[model samples]
Target chain A: MTVPTGQCCAPIAREPLAEDTAAELAVMLKAVADPVRLRLLSMIGSHAGGEACVCDLTDAFDLTAPTISHHLKVLRTAGLIDGERRGTWVYYRIIPEAVNKLGALFAPLTEPSPGPVPQPVAGRSELGLLPA
Target chain B: MTVPTGQCCAPIAREPLAEDTAAELAVMLKAVADPVRLRLLSMIGSHAGGEACVCDLTDAFDLTAPTISHHLKVLRTAGLIDGERRGTWVYYRIIPEAVNKLGALFAPLTEPSPGPVPQPVAGRSELGLLPA
Candidate 1:
Protein backbone atom coordinates (compact mmCIF):
# COMPACT_ATOMS: atom_id res chain seq x y z
CA MET A 1 0.00 0.00 0.00
CA THR A 2 1.11 3.55 -0.67
CA VAL A 3 2.22 5.47 2.40
CA PRO A 4 0.36 8.68 3.23
CA THR A 5 2.31 11.88 2.75
CA GLY A 6 1.93 15.26 4.55
CA GLN A 7 3.38 14.09 7.84
CA CYS A 8 5.80 17.02 7.84
CA CYS A 9 3.22 19.80 7.99
CA ALA A 10 3.65 22.36 10.76
CA PRO A 11 1.36 22.48 13.74
CA ILE A 12 -1.77 24.59 13.21
CA ALA A 13 -0.90 26.86 16.09
CA ARG A 14 2.51 27.68 14.61
CA GLU A 15 1.08 28.92 11.33
CA PRO A 16 -2.08 28.94 9.31
CA LEU A 17 -2.48 25.73 7.33
CA ALA A 18 -2.81 26.07 3.59
CA GLU A 19 -6.31 25.47 2.22
CA ASP A 20 -5.55 22.17 0.52
CA THR A 21 -3.78 20.87 3.59
CA ALA A 22 -6.69 21.84 5.77
CA ALA A 23 -9.05 19.99 3.43
CA GLU A 24 -7.03 16.82 3.71
CA LEU A 25 -6.91 17.05 7.47
CA ALA A 26 -10.61 17.78 7.68
CA VAL A 27 -11.34 14.57 5.78
CA MET A 28 -9.34 12.46 8.18
CA LEU A 29 -10.75 14.19 11.23
CA LYS A 30 -14.25 13.75 9.89
CA ALA A 31 -13.78 10.03 9.56
CA VAL A 32 -12.91 9.59 13.19
CA ALA A 33 -15.49 12.07 14.42
CA ASP A 34 -18.12 9.53 15.33
CA PRO A 35 -18.38 8.08 18.81
CA VAL A 36 -18.33 4.51 17.55
CA ARG A 37 -15.34 5.10 15.37
CA LEU A 38 -13.42 6.83 18.16
CA ARG A 39 -14.10 3.95 20.48
CA LEU A 40 -13.08 1.49 17.81
CA LEU A 41 -9.83 3.36 17.33
CA SER A 42 -9.20 3.36 21.07
CA MET A 43 -9.91 -0.34 21.27
CA ILE A 44 -7.60 -1.08 18.39
CA GLY A 45 -4.84 1.12 19.75
CA SER A 46 -4.92 -0.24 23.28
CA HIS A 47 -5.52 -3.85 22.46
CA ALA A 48 -2.93 -6.40 23.46
CA GLY A 49 -0.14 -6.65 20.85
CA GLY A 50 -1.51 -3.31 19.60
CA GLU A 51 -4.14 -4.94 17.46
CA ALA A 52 -7.55 -6.54 17.69
CA CYS A 53 -9.66 -8.75 15.48
CA VAL A 54 -13.08 -7.76 14.15
CA CYS A 55 -14.75 -10.41 16.28
CA ASP A 56 -13.31 -8.99 19.46
CA LEU A 57 -14.45 -5.49 18.67
CA THR A 58 -18.06 -6.35 17.89
CA ASP A 59 -18.81 -7.58 21.37
CA ALA A 60 -17.87 -4.30 22.95
CA PHE A 61 -20.55 -2.40 21.06
CA ASP A 62 -24.31 -2.60 21.21
CA LEU A 63 -24.41 -2.28 17.44
CA THR A 64 -24.51 -5.00 14.83
CA ALA A 65 -21.52 -6.49 13.04
CA PRO A 66 -22.12 -4.60 9.83
CA THR A 67 -22.35 -1.31 11.70
CA ILE A 68 -19.08 -1.96 13.43
CA SER A 69 -17.58 -3.04 10.15
CA HIS A 70 -18.75 0.20 8.60
CA HIS A 71 -16.99 2.26 11.24
CA LEU A 72 -13.78 0.28 10.78
CA LYS A 73 -13.96 0.81 7.06
CA VAL A 74 -14.28 4.56 7.61
CA LEU A 75 -11.16 4.51 9.76
CA ARG A 76 -9.24 2.56 7.15
CA THR A 77 -10.30 4.93 4.39
CA ALA A 78 -9.18 7.86 6.52
CA GLY A 79 -5.73 6.22 6.89
CA LEU A 80 -6.10 6.06 10.62
CA ILE A 81 -6.15 2.25 10.81
CA ASP A 82 -5.47 -0.80 8.68
CA GLY A 83 -7.12 -4.14 8.40
CA GLU A 84 -5.89 -7.43 7.05
CA ARG A 85 -7.70 -10.69 6.83
CA ARG A 86 -6.29 -13.84 8.34
CA GLY A 87 -8.46 -16.86 7.72
CA THR A 88 -12.01 -15.74 8.40
CA TRP A 89 -11.19 -12.79 10.64
CA VAL A 90 -9.65 -9.39 10.05
CA TYR A 91 -7.43 -7.72 12.62
CA TYR A 92 -6.97 -3.97 12.88
CA ARG A 93 -4.37 -1.68 14.37
CA ILE A 94 -3.83 2.06 14.66
CA ILE A 95 -1.69 3.84 12.07
CA PRO A 96 0.79 5.52 14.35
CA GLU A 97 1.95 8.18 11.91
CA ALA A 98 -1.57 9.29 11.09
CA VAL A 99 -2.39 9.50 14.76
CA ASN A 100 0.83 11.38 15.31
CA LYS A 101 0.05 13.83 12.55
CA LEU A 102 -3.16 14.69 14.32
CA GLY A 103 -1.38 15.12 17.60
CA ALA A 104 1.16 17.37 15.90
CA LEU A 105 -1.61 19.47 14.36
CA PHE A 106 -2.84 20.47 17.79
CA ALA A 107 0.51 20.39 19.57
CA PRO A 108 1.05 24.11 19.26
CA LEU A 109 -2.36 24.91 20.69
CA THR A 110 -1.84 22.56 23.60
CA GLU A 111 1.79 23.24 24.35
CA PRO A 112 2.22 25.42 27.40
CA SER A 113 2.10 29.08 26.49
CA PRO A 114 5.64 30.21 25.83
CA GLY A 115 7.31 33.47 26.87
CA PRO A 116 5.19 36.03 28.66
CA VAL A 117 1.46 35.98 28.13
CA PRO A 118 0.64 38.93 25.96
CA GLN A 119 -1.86 41.28 27.44
CA PRO A 120 -5.20 41.21 25.67
CA VAL A 121 -5.00 43.46 22.66
CA ALA A 122 -6.43 46.95 22.89
CA GLY A 123 -9.82 46.19 21.38
CA ARG A 124 -10.26 42.49 22.24
CA SER A 125 -11.67 40.85 25.34
CA GLU A 126 -9.46 38.56 27.42
CA LEU A 127 -12.16 35.89 27.50
CA GLY A 128 -11.04 33.71 24.61
CA LEU A 129 -8.56 31.37 26.33
CA LEU A 130 -10.71 30.19 29.18
CA PRO A 131 -11.15 26.41 29.24
CA ALA A 132 -14.17 25.46 27.24
CA MET B 1 -19.75 31.43 30.48
CA THR B 2 -19.75 28.08 32.28
CA VAL B 3 -16.45 26.38 31.74
CA PRO B 4 -16.78 23.13 29.79
CA THR B 5 -16.01 20.03 31.78
CA GLY B 6 -14.16 16.83 30.71
CA GLN B 7 -10.75 18.40 30.36
CA CYS B 8 -9.14 15.77 32.55
CA CYS B 9 -10.05 12.57 30.71
CA ALA B 10 -7.23 10.21 29.84
CA PRO B 11 -5.94 9.94 26.32
CA ILE B 12 -7.72 7.54 23.98
CA ALA B 13 -4.59 5.49 23.40
CA ARG B 14 -4.04 4.98 27.10
CA GLU B 15 -7.29 3.09 27.49
CA PRO B 16 -10.68 2.65 25.91
CA LEU B 17 -12.59 5.87 26.53
CA ALA B 18 -15.96 5.64 28.25
CA GLU B 19 -18.98 5.76 25.95
CA ASP B 20 -20.09 9.17 27.17
CA THR B 21 -16.59 10.55 26.96
CA ALA B 22 -16.22 9.34 23.42
CA ALA B 23 -19.58 10.94 22.57
CA GLU B 24 -18.43 14.31 23.81
CA LEU B 25 -15.18 14.05 21.88
CA ALA B 26 -17.04 13.04 18.76
CA VAL B 27 -19.15 16.18 18.99
CA MET B 28 -16.09 18.38 19.15
CA LEU B 29 -14.27 16.52 16.40
CA LYS B 30 -17.28 16.63 14.12
CA ALA B 31 -17.42 20.38 14.46
CA VAL B 32 -13.85 20.64 13.27
CA ALA B 33 -14.34 18.18 10.45
CA ASP B 34 -15.06 20.75 7.78
CA PRO B 35 -12.37 22.27 5.60
CA VAL B 36 -13.46 25.85 6.13
CA ARG B 37 -13.74 25.31 9.84
CA LEU B 38 -10.28 23.80 9.98
CA ARG B 39 -8.74 26.69 8.09
CA LEU B 40 -10.60 29.19 10.20
CA LEU B 41 -9.28 27.43 13.30
CA SER B 42 -5.73 27.55 11.97
CA MET B 43 -6.10 31.21 11.21
CA ILE B 44 -7.47 31.98 14.67
CA GLY B 45 -4.84 29.87 16.35
CA SER B 46 -1.86 31.33 14.54
CA HIS B 47 -2.96 34.93 14.31
CA ALA B 48 -0.83 37.64 15.91
CA GLY B 49 -1.52 37.87 19.62
CA GLY B 50 -3.12 34.47 19.13
CA GLU B 51 -6.46 36.07 18.38
CA ALA B 52 -8.21 37.62 15.42
CA CYS B 53 -11.33 39.63 14.86
CA VAL B 54 -14.17 38.37 12.66
CA CYS B 55 -13.42 41.05 10.12
CA ASP B 56 -9.84 39.87 9.84
CA LEU B 57 -10.84 36.24 9.48
CA THR B 58 -13.45 36.84 6.77
CA ASP B 59 -10.81 38.24 4.44
CA ALA B 60 -8.73 35.04 4.49
CA PHE B 61 -11.43 32.98 2.83
CA ASP B 62 -12.99 33.23 -0.62
CA LEU B 63 -16.30 33.03 1.20
CA THR B 64 -18.98 35.50 2.17
CA ALA B 65 -19.00 37.07 5.60
CA PRO B 66 -22.05 35.04 6.56
CA THR B 67 -20.39 31.85 5.43
CA ILE B 68 -17.29 32.61 7.43
CA SER B 69 -19.42 33.57 10.38
CA HIS B 70 -21.16 30.21 10.16
CA HIS B 71 -17.87 28.39 10.25
CA LEU B 72 -16.64 30.41 13.20
CA LYS B 73 -19.90 29.71 14.98
CA VAL B 74 -19.32 26.01 14.48
CA LEU B 75 -15.85 26.29 16.01
CA ARG B 76 -17.22 28.24 18.93
CA THR B 77 -20.00 25.74 19.46
CA ALA B 78 -17.44 22.94 19.48
CA GLY B 79 -15.63 24.72 22.28
CA LEU B 80 -12.47 24.88 20.20
CA ILE B 81 -12.65 28.67 20.03
CA ASP B 82 -14.30 31.56 21.77
CA GLY B 83 -15.58 34.86 20.41
CA GLU B 84 -16.50 37.95 22.33
CA ARG B 85 -17.71 41.28 21.02
CA ARG B 86 -15.51 44.27 21.65
CA GLY B 87 -16.95 47.44 20.14
CA THR B 88 -18.43 46.57 16.75
CA TRP B 89 -16.27 43.48 16.13
CA VAL B 90 -16.07 40.03 17.67
CA TYR B 91 -12.57 38.68 18.18
CA TYR B 92 -11.87 34.99 18.41
CA ARG B 93 -9.09 32.95 19.97
CA ILE B 94 -8.26 29.34 20.53
CA ILE B 95 -9.47 27.72 23.72
CA PRO B 96 -6.14 26.40 24.95
CA GLU B 97 -7.67 23.74 27.20
CA ALA B 98 -10.01 22.39 24.56
CA VAL B 99 -7.27 22.17 22.00
CA ASN B 100 -5.06 20.60 24.65
CA LYS B 101 -7.68 17.99 25.36
CA LEU B 102 -7.69 17.04 21.69
CA GLY B 103 -3.91 16.89 21.64
CA ALA B 104 -3.90 14.75 24.76
CA LEU B 105 -6.50 12.42 23.26
CA PHE B 106 -3.98 11.31 20.68
CA ALA B 107 -0.80 11.85 22.70
CA PRO B 108 -0.39 8.21 23.64
CA LEU B 109 -0.82 7.17 20.04
CA THR B 110 1.88 9.60 18.93
CA GLU B 111 4.36 9.19 21.77
CA PRO B 112 7.27 6.93 20.87
CA SER B 113 6.11 3.39 21.07
CA PRO B 114 7.36 1.71 24.23
CA GLY B 115 9.06 -1.65 24.70
CA PRO B 116 10.25 -4.25 22.22
CA VAL B 117 8.13 -4.90 19.19
CA PRO B 118 5.94 -7.89 19.76
CA GLN B 119 5.88 -10.80 17.35
CA PRO B 120 2.90 -10.70 15.05
CA VAL B 121 0.16 -12.88 16.44
CA ALA B 122 -0.61 -16.15 14.71
CA GLY B 123 -3.81 -15.00 13.06
CA ARG B 124 -3.00 -11.39 12.14
CA SER B 125 -1.01 -9.68 9.43
CA GLU B 126 1.88 -7.40 10.43
CA LEU B 127 1.07 -4.72 7.85
CA GLY B 128 -0.96 -2.41 10.06
CA LEU B 129 1.68 0.08 11.15
CA LEU B 130 2.83 1.26 7.74
CA PRO B 131 2.58 5.07 7.56
CA ALA B 132 -0.74 6.39 6.33
Candidate 2:
Protein backbone atom coordinates (compact mmCIF):
# COMPACT_ATOMS: atom_id res chain seq x y z
CA MET A 1 0.00 0.00 0.00
CA THR A 2 1.02 3.66 -0.40
CA VAL A 3 1.52 6.01 2.57
CA PRO A 4 1.95 9.74 2.20
CA THR A 5 4.42 11.53 4.44
CA GLY A 6 3.23 14.70 6.10
CA GLN A 7 4.74 17.12 8.59
CA CYS A 8 3.20 15.29 11.56
CA CYS A 9 4.43 11.99 10.09
CA ALA A 10 7.93 13.42 9.84
CA PRO A 11 10.64 11.74 11.92
CA ILE A 12 11.47 14.72 14.05
CA ALA A 13 9.48 16.52 16.76
CA ARG A 14 10.60 20.02 15.71
CA GLU A 15 8.24 20.34 12.79
CA PRO A 16 4.60 21.42 13.11
CA LEU A 17 1.73 19.31 11.84
CA ALA A 18 -0.55 20.39 8.98
CA GLU A 19 -4.33 20.64 9.41
CA ASP A 20 -5.09 17.78 7.09
CA THR A 21 -2.28 15.77 8.57
CA ALA A 22 -3.60 16.12 12.13
CA ALA A 23 -7.08 15.15 10.97
CA GLU A 24 -5.74 12.06 9.29
CA LEU A 25 -3.74 11.15 12.35
CA ALA A 26 -6.78 11.79 14.56
CA VAL A 27 -8.85 9.33 12.56
CA MET A 28 -6.38 6.54 13.28
CA LEU A 29 -6.00 7.60 16.91
CA LYS A 30 -9.74 7.55 17.40
CA ALA A 31 -9.83 3.90 16.43
CA VAL A 32 -7.61 2.99 19.36
CA ALA A 33 -9.44 5.25 21.80
CA ASP A 34 -11.73 2.52 23.06
CA PRO A 35 -10.72 0.23 25.93
CA VAL A 36 -11.97 -2.88 24.16
CA ARG A 37 -10.18 -1.95 20.95
CA LEU A 38 -6.98 -1.11 22.79
CA ARG A 39 -7.05 -4.52 24.45
CA LEU A 40 -7.91 -6.07 21.11
CA LEU A 41 -4.98 -4.37 19.39
CA SER A 42 -2.67 -5.49 22.19
CA MET A 43 -3.84 -9.05 21.73
CA ILE A 44 -3.48 -8.85 17.96
CA GLY A 45 -0.08 -7.19 18.09
CA SER A 46 1.05 -9.85 20.51
CA HIS A 47 -0.58 -12.66 18.58
CA ALA A 48 1.39 -15.39 16.87
CA GLY A 49 2.30 -14.66 13.25
CA GLY A 50 1.39 -11.06 14.18
CA GLU A 51 -2.25 -12.01 13.67
CA ALA A 52 -5.16 -13.57 15.51
CA CYS A 53 -8.32 -15.46 14.74
CA VAL A 54 -11.74 -14.13 15.77
CA CYS A 55 -12.37 -17.33 17.70
CA ASP A 56 -9.23 -16.83 19.73
CA LEU A 57 -10.02 -13.16 20.33
CA THR A 58 -13.53 -13.88 21.62
CA ASP A 59 -12.27 -16.12 24.38
CA ALA A 60 -9.78 -13.55 25.70
CA PHE A 61 -12.33 -10.85 26.49
CA ASP A 62 -15.37 -11.07 28.72
CA LEU A 63 -17.42 -9.06 26.20
CA THR A 64 -20.04 -10.70 24.04
CA ALA A 65 -19.19 -12.17 20.65
CA PRO A 66 -21.10 -9.41 18.88
CA THR A 67 -19.29 -6.77 20.89
CA ILE A 68 -15.95 -8.25 19.91
CA SER A 69 -17.04 -8.34 16.31
CA HIS A 70 -18.09 -4.71 16.46
CA HIS A 71 -14.76 -3.65 17.94
CA LEU A 72 -12.95 -5.63 15.26
CA LYS A 73 -15.01 -3.92 12.63
CA VAL A 74 -14.01 -0.51 13.99
CA LEU A 75 -10.36 -1.49 13.97
CA ARG A 76 -10.67 -2.84 10.44
CA THR A 77 -12.43 0.32 9.32
CA ALA A 78 -9.69 2.50 10.81
CA GLY A 79 -7.00 0.55 8.91
CA LEU A 80 -5.40 -0.48 12.19
CA ILE A 81 -6.25 -4.16 11.60
CA ASP A 82 -7.05 -6.36 8.65
CA GLY A 83 -9.26 -9.42 8.53
CA GLU A 84 -9.81 -12.33 6.17
CA ARG A 85 -12.19 -15.27 6.28
CA ARG A 86 -10.74 -18.73 5.99
CA GLY A 87 -13.12 -21.65 6.32
CA THR A 88 -15.06 -21.34 9.58
CA TRP A 89 -12.79 -18.79 11.26
CA VAL A 90 -11.78 -15.27 10.35
CA TYR A 91 -8.22 -14.11 11.06
CA TYR A 92 -7.08 -10.60 11.88
CA ARG A 93 -3.65 -8.99 11.71
CA ILE A 94 -2.21 -5.62 12.59
CA ILE A 95 -1.73 -3.47 9.52
CA PRO A 96 1.94 -2.55 9.60
CA GLU A 97 1.45 0.66 7.65
CA ALA A 98 -1.14 1.87 10.09
CA VAL A 99 0.96 0.93 13.07
CA ASN A 100 4.12 2.27 11.48
CA LYS A 101 2.42 5.46 10.52
CA LEU A 102 1.29 5.94 14.10
CA GLY A 103 4.76 5.09 15.32
CA ALA A 104 6.42 7.34 12.76
CA LEU A 105 4.28 10.18 13.95
CA PHE A 106 6.46 10.12 17.05
CA ALA A 107 9.89 9.53 15.48
CA PRO A 108 12.64 11.86 16.64
CA LEU A 109 14.25 13.55 13.65
CA THR A 110 18.00 13.83 13.30
CA GLU A 111 20.05 16.79 12.18
CA PRO A 112 22.32 14.92 9.77
CA SER A 113 22.66 11.20 10.57
CA PRO A 114 23.54 10.67 14.21
CA GLY A 115 19.85 10.23 15.27
CA PRO A 116 17.16 12.38 16.76
CA VAL A 117 18.03 13.72 20.17
CA PRO A 118 15.05 14.59 22.28
CA GLN A 119 15.75 18.19 23.29
CA PRO A 120 13.15 19.57 25.61
CA VAL A 121 12.84 23.27 25.03
CA ALA A 122 12.11 24.74 28.44
CA GLY A 123 10.59 28.01 27.35
CA ARG A 124 11.22 30.36 24.44
CA SER A 125 14.21 31.41 22.23
CA GLU A 126 14.51 28.00 20.54
CA LEU A 127 11.93 28.81 17.89
CA GLY A 128 14.56 29.63 15.31
CA LEU A 129 15.54 25.97 14.90
CA LEU A 130 12.07 24.89 13.76
CA PRO A 131 11.13 24.56 10.10
CA ALA A 132 9.66 27.47 8.18
CA MET B 1 12.89 14.52 31.26
CA THR B 2 12.83 10.77 31.88
CA VAL B 3 11.14 8.44 29.40
CA PRO B 4 10.04 4.82 29.69
CA THR B 5 10.91 2.23 27.07
CA GLY B 6 9.14 -1.06 26.44
CA GLN B 7 8.39 -3.65 23.73
CA CYS B 8 6.13 -1.20 21.92
CA CYS B 9 8.49 1.73 22.35
CA ALA B 10 11.23 -0.61 20.98
CA PRO B 11 11.50 1.12 17.55
CA ILE B 12 10.32 -1.95 15.68
CA ALA B 13 6.99 -3.63 15.09
CA ARG B 14 8.19 -7.19 15.66
CA GLU B 15 7.89 -7.40 19.43
CA PRO B 16 4.49 -7.76 20.99
CA LEU B 17 3.09 -4.86 23.02
CA ALA B 18 2.53 -5.46 26.71
CA GLU B 19 -0.95 -4.78 28.05
CA ASP B 20 0.35 -1.81 30.03
CA THR B 21 2.25 -0.50 27.03
CA ALA B 22 -0.86 -0.51 24.89
CA ALA B 23 -2.76 1.27 27.66
CA GLU B 24 -0.10 3.92 27.96
CA LEU B 25 0.03 4.47 24.23
CA ALA B 26 -3.76 4.56 24.12
CA VAL B 27 -3.84 7.30 26.76
CA MET B 28 -1.56 9.50 24.71
CA LEU B 29 -3.45 8.72 21.49
CA LYS B 30 -6.72 9.65 23.11
CA ALA B 31 -5.32 13.10 23.86
CA VAL B 32 -4.90 13.72 20.15
CA ALA B 33 -8.21 12.14 19.22
CA ASP B 34 -10.14 15.39 19.17
CA PRO B 35 -10.45 17.68 16.16
CA VAL B 36 -9.75 20.83 18.15
CA ARG B 37 -6.85 19.25 19.99
CA LEU B 38 -5.40 17.90 16.73
CA ARG B 39 -5.38 21.42 15.38
CA LEU B 40 -3.82 22.62 18.59
CA LEU B 41 -1.08 20.00 18.39
CA SER B 42 -0.48 20.82 14.72
CA MET B 43 -0.15 24.45 15.62
CA ILE B 44 2.11 23.61 18.54
CA GLY B 45 4.19 21.16 16.53
CA SER B 46 4.40 23.57 13.60
CA HIS B 47 4.96 26.66 15.66
CA ALA B 48 8.25 28.48 15.43
CA GLY B 49 10.60 27.18 18.16
CA GLY B 50 8.17 24.26 18.47
CA GLU B 51 5.52 26.10 20.53
CA ALA B 52 2.58 28.48 20.39
CA CYS B 53 1.36 31.18 22.69
CA VAL B 54 -2.15 30.94 24.10
CA CYS B 55 -3.01 34.36 22.72
CA ASP B 56 -1.89 33.30 19.28
CA LEU B 57 -3.81 30.05 19.54
CA THR B 58 -7.02 31.74 20.66
CA ASP B 59 -7.26 33.90 17.56
CA ALA B 60 -6.61 31.03 15.15
CA PHE B 61 -9.71 29.06 16.10
CA ASP B 62 -13.37 30.07 16.30
CA LEU B 63 -13.80 28.43 19.69
CA THR B 64 -14.14 30.42 22.88
CA ALA B 65 -11.32 31.06 25.30
CA PRO B 66 -12.75 28.57 27.79
CA THR B 67 -13.08 25.91 25.12
CA ILE B 68 -9.51 26.47 23.99
CA SER B 69 -8.35 26.37 27.57
CA HIS B 70 -10.21 23.12 28.09
CA HIS B 71 -8.53 21.55 25.08
CA LEU B 72 -5.15 22.77 26.17
CA LYS B 73 -5.81 21.33 29.60
CA VAL B 74 -6.61 17.97 28.05
CA LEU B 75 -3.39 18.03 26.06
CA ARG B 76 -1.41 19.06 29.12
CA THR B 77 -2.94 16.35 31.27
CA ALA B 78 -2.24 13.75 28.58
CA GLY B 79 1.41 14.91 28.37
CA LEU B 80 1.21 15.76 24.67
CA ILE B 81 1.82 19.45 25.35
CA ASP B 82 3.07 21.53 28.24
CA GLY B 83 2.35 25.14 29.10
CA GLU B 84 3.65 27.79 31.47
CA ARG B 85 2.51 31.30 32.08
CA ARG B 86 4.92 34.14 31.39
CA GLY B 87 3.36 37.33 32.72
CA THR B 88 0.75 38.08 30.06
CA TRP B 89 0.80 35.13 27.70
CA VAL B 90 0.91 31.40 28.32
CA TYR B 91 3.23 29.53 25.98
CA TYR B 92 2.63 25.92 25.06
CA ARG B 93 5.14 23.64 23.41
CA ILE B 94 5.08 20.05 22.28
CA ILE B 95 6.62 17.89 24.98
CA PRO B 96 9.61 16.21 23.35
CA GLU B 97 9.42 13.11 25.55
CA ALA B 98 5.77 12.69 24.79
CA VAL B 99 6.26 13.18 21.05
CA ASN B 100 9.43 11.09 20.90
CA LYS B 101 7.86 8.33 22.92
CA LEU B 102 5.03 8.21 20.42
CA GLY B 103 7.48 8.41 17.52
CA ALA B 104 9.67 5.76 19.07
CA LEU B 105 6.62 3.61 19.43
CA PHE B 106 6.48 3.53 15.60
CA ALA B 107 10.21 3.62 14.86
CA PRO B 108 11.41 1.04 12.36
CA LEU B 109 13.19 -1.63 14.35
CA THR B 110 16.55 -2.65 12.99
CA GLU B 111 17.27 -6.38 12.98
CA PRO B 112 20.91 -7.43 13.39
CA SER B 113 22.38 -4.40 11.62
CA PRO B 114 20.60 -3.63 8.35
CA GLY B 115 17.06 -2.59 9.33
CA PRO B 116 13.59 -4.02 9.78
CA VAL B 117 12.17 -5.55 6.63
CA PRO B 118 8.38 -5.56 6.65
CA GLN B 119 7.55 -9.20 6.11
CA PRO B 120 3.97 -9.76 5.14
CA VAL B 121 3.00 -13.18 6.44
CA ALA B 122 0.29 -14.57 4.18
CA GLY B 123 -0.83 -17.49 6.35
CA ARG B 124 1.02 -18.99 9.32
CA SER B 125 4.58 -19.73 8.30
CA GLU B 126 5.90 -16.60 10.03
CA LEU B 127 4.63 -17.39 13.53
CA GLY B 128 8.04 -18.55 14.64
CA LEU B 129 9.61 -15.11 14.12
CA LEU B 130 7.47 -13.51 16.82
CA PRO B 131 8.44 -13.30 20.47
CA ALA B 132 7.29 -15.77 23.09
Q: Candidate 2 chain B, which ten residues in sequence have the lowest lDDT sum?
A: B123-132
Residue B123, candidate 1: C-alpha displacement in angstroms: 13
Per-residue lDDT tens digits of candidate 1, residues B37-68? Answer: 88888888888998999998888788999999
Provide all candidates' interface root-mean-square deviations.
Answer: 10.4, 9.4
lDDT at B59, model 2: 85
Question: Candidate 1 vs. truth: CA RMSD?
Answer: 11.1
Q: What tens digits encode model 1's per-residue C-alpha lDDT throughout A1-132?
A: 111342445666766778788889998999989999998898777665776888778887889999999999999999998888988778787776677778767664445555533222212111111123
TM-score of candidate 1 on Cα atoms, chains taken together: 0.79
Which 10-residue window in model 2 chain A sums to the lowest lDDT? A121-130
Give the poorly placed runs of model 2, Cα more than 4 Å off.
A1-14, A112-132, B1-15, B109-132
Error of 2 at A55 (Å): 1.6
Task: List model 2 lDDT by residue over A1-132, tens digit each.
Answer: 112332234543444555566677788889877666876776665554555777766765578999999999999999888888877778787766577666665655545334343322212111111123
What are the per-residue Cα lDDT tens digits for candidate 2 across B46-113? 67877789988888778899999999998888877889888998999877767777676655433322
